[model samples]
Target: MIYSEKENVKSLIEMSLKVIRMYDWLLDLYVLDFFVDDHWEKLPKTWRDSFRDMDPQHLGEILSNKPPKQLLPLSFLALIKSVDALSIPRQNTYKPAHKIDLKNLDNCKNHPRLKNLFLKHVKLKKRHEISMMADVVVDTAMQTGCNAVIDFGSGLGHLVRVLAYRDDLYAAGIECQRQLTEEARKLDLELEYTAKKHISPEAASKLHRPLHFNITLSCYSQLVKLPLPETMMNYGLIGLHPCGDLGPLLLKHFVESEHVKFICVVGCCYMKLSCEGKQQGYPMSDYVNRLDSKLSFPSREIACHAIEVYCERLMKGNYKDLKIHAYRAALERILVEHDPKLRHAPVRSIKHSDSMTFENYCSLALERIKLPLPTSPSVWSRGYHDLQQWRRVVVVYTLRLALAPLVETVVLLDRMLYVMEKGMSCEIRPVFDPKLSPRNHIIIARR
Candidate 1:
């Protein structure tokens, strides 16, 4: 059932607290420590037996083949069913109560020719979903009476360009990477020249003279140090998909800055967030931070899980190429046995060709980590093909997958609560189709 924004925020915080209370067990279970740690024997007998009894050939036959869904053996199906039962209800976070209409922009009456020009330019360069998101943000900004827009973590200034061209608003982009900022500036110049050539001089003169958008090349961590335009009074903050800490930082800035009147942000890369120190991304609100029961951060892998994508893929029965997890697990087992020091070291990713075999994959991984090649490739190949070993890895992997939704719910809810606690109006809604853009939840707030 759908709940009000205040109710949803309360429920999410309580649910997250419960998960944190069981942090010790959840860490061991969801992090796949049963496979990573050397103490598999210490786990409960029932847990160990579940993995041991799984039929490797049955799993391979079902997951390896492409196409129509295949019925699994009773044992495999039973384990999956039990795991599904443990899943936390994520309906409130995954599906929003209200629908966001992109076509609403067509009704707005401001700069009809300029809007047409901006829409056509962005449509040709960006994906359909992204273009729709931009249209919605510009419409919102205009209706809210915002005189300027500042896009945080603007990658190539796609949104900034559209906002400036569509209306007479002064637009600016804050980008951390120098290379991306330079590329966006070049594209901005090209777009301006092209727009001037296509439209009449009278129409072009109506737009901001010179039609140039400012792009600042400085890390968002130093946002307070950056200078805002003194001439602009009201500003709208927009972020297409601000990754990691930048999302929370943007919300904090919006509430504190007198100039910012509205904000629309889509956050991503939860795993990259820092949970400790002054710049912690999660628990942004003073209410949650001051609670007696402290919250523990999930591992990088667990935090990175995209639960909505998993649900969509599972429903479509598109399970193929899952053997990569088994292959990686086998390599980890080998590393733990031989090189104790490098067992936990991060391995650099290498390109995986479809034709590459398990042995070749392991070799490339070892080489990337600066380790010597295995003395006997045949021995390792046998271990990978061994039915029991393969089944054990897949079963553990399934358990981790089940907890993904709960973890994502906590992260998204934290952002929503942070904005609400500051006495501002805010809501979380699905702005884009999950099938097209998995990170589709947009956190919209206004002061």
Candidate 2:
């Protein structure tokens, strides 16, 4: 029985790999044809057929003169051009700040997370990305005519501070980490001081709009169950790269609630999402259950295969992992430039890590393929260096890069649908380069 079970599991893994391969091929085709070159004729017929099925507009016109049986490249180009017209650009810019880096490092004694994160990743000049993101959210809120903004998972007042700068837009940040929130409060003082220093008396007088921001370090999951400030319902809610299951939960709140005029969310970490109030799994789980009630996570077999594929890619070369968010943005850039089929590449769960030697980890990985170890475990152990600090930086960076587009797309589409469902008029556009910030994509949904 045990042997049979093991074999069954192995078979399932292989099947899952096959599915992933097909999925990756389709994504790669999209990246190659749409983002890189307009010439769709270079793709294989099987790929062309897949594109036709998933996105006919991309291939139909080029193939219009040609028989359905024989799809040509130029035909595919015309089809792709139509789809490209409909596709939103992930890179765009808004008004550049006359002055960047509003707060000094010495002044931000209280906001340790903000200070540490900014110091570690965001430099004085490059830090414009954070402020840029904040500006986008704030601008969107202003256009929507919202008086307040609720930023969930706000680390250190990056978005809150920007919103507070505006006289008409009141802002509140909901963070689960009390320490981080406290730190952000301290940083806000520095921000205020810096503003006062820079501003003339008249400008200071103009800045007197209560720069009131509050932080509550409680789980967002729990927050949903409780009665939040009624103001939350009235304000535009935005969460930049809310991780795993958290992002989707925000979506449900925005969808079910009548009070919110706008909710901008970006989600990442697909595998980490848990069963919320009604679903048994993420994404397909709900659909599967709705169909026949057998809703569950990707079977253990699928999980193992995913891990193997992920490990194989990492093993292919020693590459530095970018910041999780930045990495997410970079991956999107790569995808937009190279191939989309790998969009679901294995994500290393930086939020969770365990101690294992490189050799041990590799051994475990190879076991999945029933392949022998290429080198002796002793030899493999010699070269491995686990730098926790470096890994943390890279993990967050890469995670941001990988996650930006997926989460952005989900949030944007959800908002678009929400507008349609509510009989409100709206349009959404990507407002920044995903490469600059993993939480880069901005939805300018106007109603």
Best candidate, TM-score-wise? 1
lDDT (Cα) of model 2: 0.43
Prediction-by-prediction clash tally: 0, 31
Alpha-carbon error at 337 in model 1, in Å? 1.3
User: lDDT per residue, candidate 1, 1-447, as tens digits?
Assistant: 123466667765675556545433443453223345633454456656544564433433333223324444454454344333432333323322324455434321243433454444354425544555565566667667777777777767766766666545677787767787787778777766766765667766655421223444223445555565664557788887777777887888888877788888887787767777787887676666765434334533464555455544444544344455556666666777676776655765555455867668777877767887577867566545642354465555554544454555566666777777777877666666554565666777777
Error of 2 at 303 (Å): 16
Please write out the lDDT profile of model 2 over residues 48-75, one tens digit for every residue. 4444343222222222222344444553
- Estimate the TM-score of every prediction: 0.74, 0.48
Residue pairs in clash, model 1: none
